[model samples]
Target: MSSAHELTQEQSDRYWQDGFLFPLSVFSEDEAAEFRAELEQVEKDWLAADLPLPLNTYKRVNAHLVIPLAARIAQDKRILDTVEGVLGPDIMIWSAEFFIKEPQTKQTVGMHQDLTYWGMGETPDQVTAWIALSPATVQSGCMDFVRGSHKNPILPHTDTYSETNLLSRGQEVAVDVSEDDKTHIELKPGQMSLHHGLTIHGSGPNASNDRRIGLAIRYLSPGAQQLVADRDYAMLARGSDAHSNFVPVQAPDALFSPEALALYEQVRLDQSKALAEGADSAVPLYTKM
Candidate 1:
């Protein structure tokens, strides 16, 4: 019998067919509130400190490396079980980022495929588990996905790098996306969504009164490899990583530990190099936030 956390066969089938699944329950509302509290506390503490980089830079990239709370959530069994149902037993976390849109913020993510800039090729072994710490509604600018877009090869993307765009390169699919083509993915606090790496997806600005907070953890199969960079970092979330495709990442024992910060910087710089390759404009991922 499958575990309670595993997705049902029907659900798994739907995910494969649609290239995405949504509003999967993982944390309870109370538990999600606790997580949000912890994240906000980290923000508050960082704002008061003399950190070399802006807090938003860490939030956009791999906050899990420096934040114990994010690391814990990234390795949560409930989330992993669901991912395992799709990607199988062996799983590696490519990255974890906190995508937070403040109320009334105009920063938007242009519709784009996740694997387009990763240099991971057209492989379908990657999945992104986006867990919401706050309500993600249409009014709040929840993600909108193009159904069955994952099956298509990586499409050409334009690097707009617009200041109002949330993406580092403002990469948008070269094809046009009409209103009828989008499926709005709305979620309550504590719920999550899983999408294929090639799935064409993006979200609008948060117009709601509250901030829209979502932790997007990218999971990869052990067989997947990064082609652009000589080195890649990942944390083995479950099963055995027989392929040894990426450098092992250790979970932080304490928030913002010295060791963790160093690791974060190393991973960030290396990943940035891969992402910015062949780009027409400056990549904003590692820049001052």
Candidate 2:
């Protein structure tokens, strides 16, 4: 892997200590704009066709499976290099989702640890790379992290299944988080942040005039496995995966190709089985807007 964009020792230490690091320049402004345009164009075309599932459904889970642009971004060397600094040479992309908060929307992601419902146990090998395609500021609902919270064991969570919550289960940490404990991470377009899977974090509603668009790509090492599910899929973004804990997948050649769409459907259904486990509500995840 290229060392050009790898995280420095101090940066890695900060991440391990604080559970999150932000404002890493991963893409140029022009490049980020191009990616945003591609995403918006896909949204425009798909929405016009009036697909049975909502547009947000496609954006919320494994978007890289069907969107070539998303796949390319997920496998970008700059991203992989930085990821490798913490996860070692071998890294697998577990999932990628576009978390979009439209202007003046009530959509909020309550304070929660991601691993609470992922069924992945308390593994330290997993990290989430959140790339900002738009300005992520306080008004744009930028994520807030509780420093060193990843050190805690997986905490209790209550599923809200709220219409305005963006989480798969609308889950939140059972404990109240004080505002003073939070570190609001703001990023400009083309910048990114990395947070541990066990990190306690959340974002409020987008009150800005423009949308807050972020592409969150989950990465895991070769040793990671899905204990609760029969099978799981991932794309090897870095070195070889000797463990083969996850089924291997290739990047799509075209956006929403017939083959890609079929694969995405199968992945969506199978993955939801794990994500929705033990949920109180029967409402399927990534199925509604």
Candidate 3:
């Protein structure tokens, strides 16, 4: 196998020091837009069927389970190779989520590090690949990160669960960060970025005329343990699961088939409960309405 997917020494070093690297071309602009069009129709059907996106946030968790393209994309060589350069070859896809910022929406996520309540064990060795299915510009609520904050202690977060907030718990970092030091992650369609699990990042509302859609896929090393007692699942993408830290999951046979949807629902509910562990407000897995 070729090592072309691996990151350069400079790219690797930048990630270690800054907690993020961005705007790397993974797909052509045309290819990404086509992918977006295909998934957009799926979302419409999902919405019409009353099983729309996740409820408490602007997320569609584990799209790979019900969306075939997403599954294939999860295994995209460019993404995996680059990730392996940082996380090692034993990779496990913990989850794939769609974070959609609708045009002229009031939804906004607060500055907070993930892994806060991920229940994904102590080591924040997890990396999230945020791929732009649409243009992820500053005007369209692109992600913003606090430089070098990934190495800091786990900051306190308060669950607001506000209606307009895009986070599941509407969680926000309970500390002040210097705005002057913030790094904006802007990507054209087909481009992607990677960020450490502890990176303090968030985005604003979509004020542009067009929507901003991104696939925030979480990739982890097999060494990381799942902390949720009743729920543990992961799909190995490369190498052996030597530690057996997570319950192995297989790929779905068909999109939205009875079997596939059933499995997807169960896991998502389990995840939502885990996320709502210490949440102050109601955090249902998806919208009840």
Candidate 4:
């Protein structure tokens, strides 16, 4: 195995100061391609099952439970070490989502704070590790952050529900973000970026000829609580979940196995309920089986 990635003290400190850090090398380009190939196969299967293909596919939700590769990737020792530097040793993977923009598409992620759409508690204890599966350039909609914006309280937002908007509620921050203050978090395949939950960020439509793909894996300390009045689920990605604050999830061995699907359904439903409970804006309807 290759050497795992770890944050230098400078990198970790810079993350807290700027609210985001990028280009953390995790896997080799060849390894990233392998993962991307696996995901392509998963997408094919999803299409065969008549699942949604456009936008950030909900197939990415709790994907570790449904897709074996995603599971293993989430538990990667290097990733855990990187996250540990920011969130400590006791970590739980609260969520995972795929942000994929096809070549020359108008699918843009609206500028918004993640907590606006997430019901995962008031404290900003979560960090999302965005692992790039393909090159993410400015033209390809690489996410950019408003430097130091994470220091502010959660800002007011509006739900546009635009068809091409990639937020859960199509939400955008109500306050104006200074264009000059933005930090474009560009990355090559196999690189990753970590951003705080309260960080103001979003991406534009992919105008380039290449696809942009990223796996956003959200990690939180065990002590983080759900803001909603409903139970939530998370996989204990590393260390012990001493608080028992969330329902536990186990890794799966096959793609969409019956056991995995059943667990995923239960967790997603509970999470969706929490999302609905705390949401002040309109939520996109999720089709239940």
* Candidate 1 residue-wise lDDT at 183: 98
lDDT of each: 0.89, 0.88, 0.80, 0.81
Better of 1 and 3 by lDDT: 1
lDDT of 1 at 278: 77
TM-score of 2: 0.96
TM-score winner:
1
RMSD of each: 1.4, 1.7, 2.3, 2.6
Q: What is the TM-score of each candidate against the true structure?
A: 0.97, 0.96, 0.92, 0.92
Model 3 over residues 1-289: C-alpha lDDT tens digits? Answer: 7666678889999998999998688889998988899887776666546444442122366777777777778888888998987898888888888888899998888899888878774475689999999988889999999879888877888887778777777889998877787888989999999998888999888999998998988998888886764776788988888888777877777667777677776776767656667766566643233
- Pick the winner on TM-score between candidates 1 and 4: 1
Candidate 4's C-alpha runs over 4 A off are: 1-4, 50-57, 277-282, 285-289
Candidate 2 Cα misplacement greater than 4 A, ranges: 50-52, 286-289
lDDT of residue 278 for candidate 3: 77
Candidate 1 runs further than 4 Å off: 287-289
Give the poorly placed runs of model 3, Cα more than 4 Å off: 1-3, 50-59, 286-289
lDDT of 1 by residue, 117-146 (tens): 897998878899999999999999999999
